[model samples]
Target: MRTKQIANRFREVILDGLWIANTNYKDQLSNITWEQATTRVESLNTIALLTFHINYYIEGVLNVLKGGALEIRDKYSFDAPKITSEEDWKILLNSLLDNAEEFASLIDTMPDEQLDNYFVDEKYGTYQRNIEAMIEHSYYHLGQITLIKKMLSNE
Candidate 1:
């Protein structure tokens, strides 16, 4: 697997919009008010919850890439702190965007040999697989956010 190719895909999915869709997390979550973000839509996760949930893995893997231990716990994935105002929501979005850029940069610098190596353990599959998973995970939640935003707008 070519690391740059994989990294490019990661950037496209995380920050830049991919060819498969015209919007990415950056575009989808922009200028969202706290009311729209925290508003519940049926049984689906709130936009805030889903946004934080998607970044949970990215932040975890990013920590590992930065030489920290993996600190992710599935139980706390959706436990984003209370967002009482727009400032709180923007803070979360900014953190997500910052991490996305840093994570993509880390992936771009990964040596080809490292890409094939297992991430943390064999159970988690290769680094390539893990990075791709982050991309897929982001896209999946991006769709959810888009839908939730549309619903909040009564569209």
Candidate 2:
């Protein structure tokens, strides 16, 4: 597949699960209240923290795609802002969606040669690998969010 085609496919599955069986972030995370978002289940990260952590890579890579240096630190990925109200949660979710859209657009414009080249440094792997990894990462956390929601609902 071409570069744009690959990027488009990634975006569809990552953002909305367009052609995938699992629920996307939009569907899974929508309608979440502050209570649900901030509730902790055992030792697992709260849904709010998981949500931000999932988007952290997207925001970092999006910056790199826009010619900025990456500034992500794994230790801080889960440090989402405190959800004091519904508006706070809404703002965070909106930012996540906005960044995802920008990242998708940037990927679509990337040269095919870039996809084959190493992303940032050779130790990190190729652009294609890193991009796909982000998709996998999001889905992984989205699953956690889904299960957490279900667990909370059952309580």
Candidate 3:
């Protein structure tokens, strides 16, 4: 019973970080193409890159949970597709949402106390830090997404 409560709390954190409030950047940036999505008016990274980066962490965490190491190589580089076609862009957007749900599910079902038991990655920090970092990381990128949209809409 206690485990379930902790699991529920972790699930809430994941949901709140990834979607609950969500900063509404995705909603405002709706109907954007993958091309424009990655286009930065200045030195700033584009929405596609931000979105990709966000998912990149989610993917990386899921991988770590599945026994992969905390890879800090160039693998997390912003390398998402520049969708010229509207259908492709839509697919990516939906995929992100679905993946976030999947991530939350993973956290929700996990043994509650295992949240800090460390997966033991030698190269990177413990699983504890990684999971906690995702919340701040996602929020940081949300700011970027919001600013990028504001910039694009202004010009």
Candidate 2 at residue 149, lDDT?
91
Model 3 has an lDDT value of 0.64
Q: TM-score of model 3 relative to the true fold? A: 0.74
lDDT of 2 at 103: 88
- Candidates in order have lDDT scores of 0.86, 0.82, 0.64
> What is the overall TM-score of model 1 with all chains considered together?
0.95
Per-residue lDDT tens digits of candidate 1, residues 1-155?
Answer: 48888888877876886586787888788868888899998898999988888778889999999989888999989889998999999988888889989998888888889988989889999998998888888778888888889898894
- Give the residue spans of candidate 3 off by over 4 A: 1-35, 66-75, 120-123
Q: Give a tens-digit lDDT track for model 3, residues 23-84.
A: 44345446577667867879998787777777777776776666667664456458776666
Looking at model 3, residue 70 earns an lDDT score of 61
Q: Predictions ranked by TM-score, top down? A: 1, 2, 3
TM-score of each: 0.95, 0.92, 0.74
Clash pairs of candidate 1? none
Between 2 and 3, whose TM-score is larger?
A: 2
Q: Give stretches of model 2 more than 4 Å off.
A: none
lDDT of 1: 0.86
Q: Largest TM-score belongs to which candidate?
A: 1
RMSD for each model, in Å, please? 1.3, 1.5, 3.7
Stronger candidate by lDDT (2 vs 3): 2
For 93-113, candidate 2 gives per-residue lDDT tens digits of: 888888888888888888888
